[model samples]
Target: MVLLPFSARNTSETNDWNGSKLKDDSKHYKLLVVGGGAGGLGAASKFARKLPRGSVGIIEPHEDHYYQPGFTLVGGGLMTLRETTRKQEKLIPSGAKWIRNEVVLFTPTQNMVTLDGGEDISYDYMVVAMGAHLRFDKIKGALEALETPGVCSNYSPFHVEKHYREVMNFQGGNAIYTYPNGPIKCAGAPQKACYITDSILRQRGVRENAHMIYATSLDKIFGVENYVKPLEEVAQEKDIDVRTRRNLIEIDTSKNSATFQLLDENGAATEDTEKIEYSLLHIGPPCSAPKALRKSPFADKTGFMDVDDGTLQSKKFPNVFGVGDCMNTPNAKTAASVSSHLKTLDRNLTFAMLGKKPYFKYDGYASCPLVVSKNRVILAEFNSKGPLETTPLNQGKPAYWAFLLKKYFMPALYWNGLIRGYWNGPATIRKFSRLVDSKKRQGVL
Candidate 1:
């Protein structure tokens, strides 16, 4: 593999090996991956190791890679912001060609993608992994409100550290946290910050004075009912007020007031508006797929890459596939979900390349380690059907052991196993544990 010298030409211009202009026609690759996030990197790593050298080309704009799940811990002070990031060059597989560019257009019809620089890259097969976009500016008063002392959010790398500072500075008052009205990565994260803040306040002997409140646009605490009951119990035990059907509308930083529109059970906005004074605010903003992909012909009506739920291939374009947060798969967006996606995508894409049908189907497995407190967690593992537990022990119950797995083992598995294309989540482990549990019951009889 050779490292091409950095050409200073504009993105639209064609270049030769000697830095001069090339002929109209250009080179292509077997696989082209857009985005360098978890899904893109995961797919690139698998293809680079399995396919011949120079077979894969990755178009990613960022020079750094982030382990985004750790951002919650960073906000909780369990990990530093520095720990969540690494150089993108280190993560991109050695054999793959890296184009430090963003995809400006997706031309599925032509089997090509145009980069921001105006250069066109053609591929025999393409994988779209450009993850979701966080739009904080869409919310009214969000930008102005966030500049105030009490306002903070953990959604972006730029704003994550402010969460801890805001929580710590809170003397005593309504400490509100929120979940936006759309699909968000790590659904448990908004509440995780609240839980961590509650624990922190208790440690500082201020828990009694602080009124912890959670305002979410969703009607339920969690999507899965199995975890919802136990999580509600945890909130009750912590004296946190959980309000559903409340959407954050505006913020008045000068007056230190947060405004919310109350919605009925049917999701219609009611006439009444609620205002609360807050000492601290943690926000989870709305997210969507990158604009380029969302507007492209490849996207579904919901603005995500329309892929087969089972095989991870585009429903309209067989040669195009997606993995990670960008795909319209019915799984919670988490690193755990990405682990499962990569496994199914690897096998199915390989089969597709061989002109054969995909044998394996993804079950929508996604896991969220609900950090209920500083030392305990409830490992919520589920698939499209419902919760899929791996441990023989009951998972709905909070356990210290589960916390340890989340804090230590899970990070290692993500960096080494998932990123290396070796991990496929805990599905096999879940199956094996079920078998062991069955045998144990028989023996007890």
Candidate 2:
């Protein structure tokens, strides 16, 4: 493939594209990646190294990239917002061409995408990794409430920093945290914020005065049953009132109250409504795939990229695949899931390019290091079947080492390993740990 030099024309259509010249109205690549988040960057990095230079292209709109898992730490006062961010340009692979724009239209049937700057991008194969969007506006007063003093959300970078402040400033009253009624990245994050706040309040001698409540749409404390028992125990020990089937529908900033709609076991909303006055409110906002994918032909009814659950390939378009939270998969939307799913995506996409049927299947693998306190975390690892723990220790119990890993090691792994295509989840590590365990049992030196 021949790489064209960027033109110097200052056309209106290419003005927002960072002044990068378009050789023509359309450009083609061997492989194209949408979004520069964990999944996109990882897959692009893998193919960029495999394909010829300039054959791989990535379309991303943002200037900054974030280590999103660190947001929980930031809200817990364990990490700063700046520590979780980096320049998006620096993270792109050397062999990949970066298209600094967002996709306005996705035409998978034509193997083409139209950018916001009106440039057409076509590729032999495409990977959609646009990730999910936090729809805070879904709740009636969420946006306005986020600007207020006591209302904050770890899901939003703008308001994440305020969570620590809100926890510290709380004198006494109801400290309410909410979980929305849809798929969200890091399903464990909502309670992480609450647990951190409980730790901080107890340290400040305010735990006795505050009534801590966790309101979630789910019927259980956690999806994975192996981890739920311990988490419920932790909640009970921390004196947190865990209310299931309660979803935050609105926030009243003027009255310092939050309204929750009660749901039945089937997740259907009932007419009963409960309003609780709060000293501080932390919301895990509802999330959805990007509007471009939602409106596209390859979208599922839930507005996510329509792909086969096990193959991660578009059902209708064989050349199109999905990675990360944007895809309609049964797994929890976490960066760890991206790391594992990308392994399946990378192999399957490569096979598709070579006109071979993909043999590898994604097991819906996902991990969540549930931070239950300041220095304790329950590392929950599982797949569609059940608990797929990496270590020999019981992962359902809170451990200090897991806390340290979540707080420190995971961030470094994300920046240096995952997005660079060097990490392929914990399968290798899990295998190694099992080998060691067997050796130990046999008394092997």
Candidate 3:
């Protein structure tokens, strides 16, 4: 196998290969994907099957691939951490070359990327799907508090299982659930774990002793208003206190207390400071694109890849595109969104390679399975404008069918249809359902 070397020094000035002062041959690829996560793998798999074997390469450091959506379930005691991860080698398509190294720098202007191991790779087209970085340490006292009892987070696979343990061991007092201030991958997950804990406590006959509180920076239960009313009702019925515009600032683990700062309507910090004691605390840490991307010139002001909202193409560099949580697209970051991104990126990138106008556009489609209880789920599907329900039945109302779809059907669809690039969300199915509904209404009239 031919090995490439990388250098932090300016590569344009130096010319050496294998200890020889020779000009490095810039290797070109049809497609280069940066991450090994869901979006990257989905895009790579699709492109690999379409492009020739040697035409595609994936730069990923980790050897293990995680089904991150399952982390919420793991925290809820419905799944295990071991079940959420798979060998990265098994997930990458057979034809695509996997470069087991992290990208240190992305030079979008030159169509090149530098790896941490001092290797340089050039591509004709690139997809940035590095995803979001969970910054647990960003919150004051979070890291230290996590080391102590009565504190946990489900955002990472490493810490998800600890959530259940913490919940089960709680004797009595406030059980706090926190949602961070920024965009979080699987937006529904943090609250889902809270609901599960509530259910578990109810089943154990300890619900009366434990006070459940959801402190979120956002004012609404959900971004899409269709599910908001129902979710609010669920919280009310479960006696879960919902506090909006409350941001977690510090944790006094010794005293088992948490500090929160209230924000005004404009999101400015206010004078109000609230402190509460807790027996169990579930934190959803602030998330952003990886630090490497933040430091790169390719990133926007928000430290995310600046991509066109509709086309998924980089604004500064036409040859570069972004998918998943790494891009500054105003869509909920989820595995379901990545499935939509894969289709959009695949078609647009191919069009760019052929020097033709891109034909496809991504409407910011994303799905969030709001697991309200052990046996029910509110399958929230929406696009940029608003809710786009796929099923003909009332999606706002939680149903057993939605629960089954989320637990059993969605995972299978993700593994088979999404990972393979066959799934482009449920747009066509949704359209068909709408057509059928129209026909049924006409007949009734």
What is the per-residue lDDT of model 1 for residues 1-445, given as tens digits with 9 covering 90 to 100?
1221223111334432234543443346667899888888888888887666676888898987888888888888888888888898998897888889898898887777888878888776788989888867766888877777888888778788988887777789999998887778888999989999999999889899999999988898888889999999999999999999888877778778888888889877898889988889887887888999999987888898898888998988887789999989999988899988988888887777666787689889999999998888999998877988889998899899998898888888878888777787788888888888899999952
- Model 1 / residue 222 / CA error / Å: 1.2
Per-prediction CA RMSD (Å): 5.5, 5.4, 5.5
| lDDT score, candidate 3, position 89 | 88
Stretches of candidate 3 off by over 4 Å are 1-28
Residue 257 local lDDT, model 2: 90
Per-residue alpha-carbon lDDT of model 2 for 310-354, expressed as tens digits?
Answer: 899999888889999999999899999998888898789878766
Model 1 TM-score is 0.92
Q: In candidate 3, residue 181 scores what lDDT? A: 77
User: Highest TM-score, which number?
Assistant: 2
Alpha-carbon local distance difference test for all models:
0.83, 0.89, 0.82
Candidate 2 regions exceeding 4 Å error are 1-26, 442-445
In candidate 2, clashing pairs total 0
Worst lDDT window (10 residues) for model 1?
Answer: 1-10
What digit string (tens of lDDT, one per residue) describes model 3 on residues 51-93? 6566678889998888788787888888888877789888888
Candidate 1 clashing pairs?
11-117
